[model samples]
Target: MIEARQLTKRYGDKTAVDGVDFTVRPGAVTGFLGPNGAGKSTTMRMIIGLDAPTAGTVTVNGRRYAEHSAPLHEVGALLEARSIHPGRSAFDHLMVLAHTHGIGRARVTEVIEMTGLQAVARKRAGAFSLGMGQRLGIAAALLGDPQTIMLDEPVNGLDPEGVLWIRTLLTGLAAEGRTVFVSSHLMSEMALVADHLIVVGRGRVLADTTVQELVLQAGGDTVDVTTDDPAGLRRVLTGPGVEISGRPGSEQLSVTGLPARAIGLAAARHGIALFELTARTVSLEEAFMELTKDSVEYHAANTLVGAA
Candidate 1:
């Protein structure tokens, strides 16, 4: 497990991370989410002792990262930036990292195969594509078979099959009771894999909750209804806290603040035959955008001519 208490970092006069407190527990994949410059990278670096925090504390198991004798066995990390020597072969790179931890060739070969790097294992790291580089980095992180795994954008530039491989790998690792903390931009994939989330913005923690809770907190439940009598059904279902919208002269009406069952019943009471009625839950992507809209540090200018 990883724990942070009031963790903070500052550079000159610019505070990169505020007093942030969170814990990443074992047996589940906890996604670390944030906008750009939200101090996610700084927090991860402090957890692994790459950068010293100006205040507060971070611990990897029960002690600071530097206090561990066998750090490789305690935690494995894949950062956003590639860290391997470009001139070295992928196989050679893993071999060297393994040697640092007293690990052997057998384990190196195992991770090589596990990350699907066999074909390019002998190729120079400089020649690998972005996807291949990501695979190699993951292979190195798994080299020690550590108890905790932290990754940033582990599936960047990966093909569909590679993305699936990463999803399965993360799930399998968490199933083995290891702590998996990852930061990613892929909300769809994170929604599918992560059991919990830690959302941050403006150097402060915005939310630390389950994926389901975040979606529900967005406060909108929608039901789509297509019927022969849109006007009649609209009138029948309209009430306090209920909203209905549709394209003018269209048969489909989108309803809010009403359950699908209620809509169906209302249609029946109005003697209106409903063609289609379905509930649509707010997706994780939509919830994230809504929650973080105010904290976005960089805003793009919309200068399109006559855009509505």
Candidate 2:
């Protein structure tokens, strides 16, 4: 398990990570999600002792990373794949990391096979493609056979096959009761792999909940109704506590605070013909965008409007 308690970091006058608290339990893949410049990399660096926190603390299991007897065996991380020496062979790189902790060649070979890098284990890392480099980095992280694993953007340059391989590998590790924490800005990817999510924005916790719970918190139970007589439907839905939107002449009306069955019954009673009445739940992508819209660092203007 990994825990952060009121953890914060600041550089000069700028605060990179604010006071945040969260726990990543074992036996599941916990996704760390945030936009660029949201301080995800900073927080991960602090957890691994790469950077000092200005306030609070983070722990792997029960001790700080620096306090571990064998830190590499307790926690393994792939913060950036390009951090490896380019001239070294994939096998040689793992061998060097293993040698640091007195680990042997057998373990290195095991990880090479485990990460499917055996085919290019002897190739120079500098010549490897981005996907191959990622595989090599993962191989190094697994060399110690650590109980906790953290990966940052593991699928950034992966093809479909490599992406699936990573998904399976992480899920398998978590199923074995190890703590798996992976960070990514891709909501669709995380939604497929993560059992729980820690959503951050602007260095603060936006949500710490199960994926289902987070979606529910984003008003998941609303239903979208599309009918020819949308205005009439709006009139029928006008009542206290029933929120209705989508203007008259619009093809759809968004209805909330009422069950789908109730909406159908009301439409039936009013002799209204419904083209569509679907219970709509906010997808993980939509929820993420809504939460981080304010924190996104860059935006592109709608060019079509300008052209017109």
Candidate 3:
């Protein structure tokens, strides 16, 4: 498990991370989300002891990362995939890390196969493609078989196959009761893999909730119904906290603050014939935009300057 209590970081006069607190428990994939310049990298650095926190504390399994006797066995991290020596082969790189912690050659070989790096295991790191480098970094992370795994943009350089592979790997690891904390800008990918989320904005914690709950909070279920009596049905379904909207003079209505079942029941009781009734939940990307709209550091104009 990973826990942060009022964790903070500052450089010179700027505060990169404010007092943030959250717990990443085992057995689930917890996604870390934030816009650019939102202190996500700083916070992850602090967790792994790459950067010292100005205040508060972060711990892995009840101890700071540096305090662990076998740090690799406790936490596997992939902060920077290219932070490897260019002259060394993938096999040699894994061997070096394994040797540092008394891990045997068999484990190194195992990780190479596990990461699908066996074909290029003997190639120098500098000659590897971006995707292959990412695979090597992931191999190093899994070499220790740590209880906690932390990765920043693990899918950044991956192809579709590699992306799918990592997704399956992360979920599989979580199923085995390991703590998996990954930061990603891919909302669709996170929606598929993450069970929980920690969304930050401008150096502060903006949200800490389950993925489905956050989606519902940002935009409740929307129901679309095409009925013959649009006016009468609108009046019948209208209630406190309910919202109903439709195109001008159209028979279809969009509704919020109620479920489709309730709408169907109401329509039947009122003799409104419904041709279509569908419920839609907001996408994760939509929810992220809604929740972090004010926190985005940069905004692009919607219209193109040269467009007619």
Best by lDDT: 3
Per-residue CA lDDT of model 2 for 107-176, tens digit only, reads: 9989888888888999889999989999988887787899999999999789999999999999999999
Sort the predicted structures by TM-score, highest score first.
3, 2, 1
* Candidate 1 runs further than 4 Å off: 224-258, 270-278, 304-308
Question: Ten consecutive residues with minimal summed lDDT in candidate 3?
Answer: 212-221
The C-alpha TM-scores of every prediction are: 0.87, 0.90, 0.91
In terms of lDDT, model 2 sits at 0.90
Candidate 3: give its CA RMSD in angstroms.
Answer: 2.4
lDDT of 3: 0.95
Model 3 misplaced stretches (Cα beyond 4 Å): 226-231, 238-252, 273-278, 301-308
The Cα error of candidate 2 at residue 39, in Å, is: 0.5
Using TM-score as the measure, name the better of candidate 2 and candidate 3.
3
lDDT tens string, model 1, 207-270? 9999988987874688999998899988999899888999989999999889999999878877
CA RMSD of each candidate after superposition = 3.7, 2.7, 2.4
lDDT of 3 by residue, 1-308 (tens): 99999999999899999999999999999999999988999999999999999999999999999999999999999999999999999999999999999999999999999999989999999999999999999999999999999999999889999999999999999999999999999999999999999999999999999999999887678999999899999899989979999998899999989999999999999899999999998999999999999999877789988899
Candidate 2 segments exceeding 4 Å error: 228-243, 248-251, 256-262, 278-281, 301-308
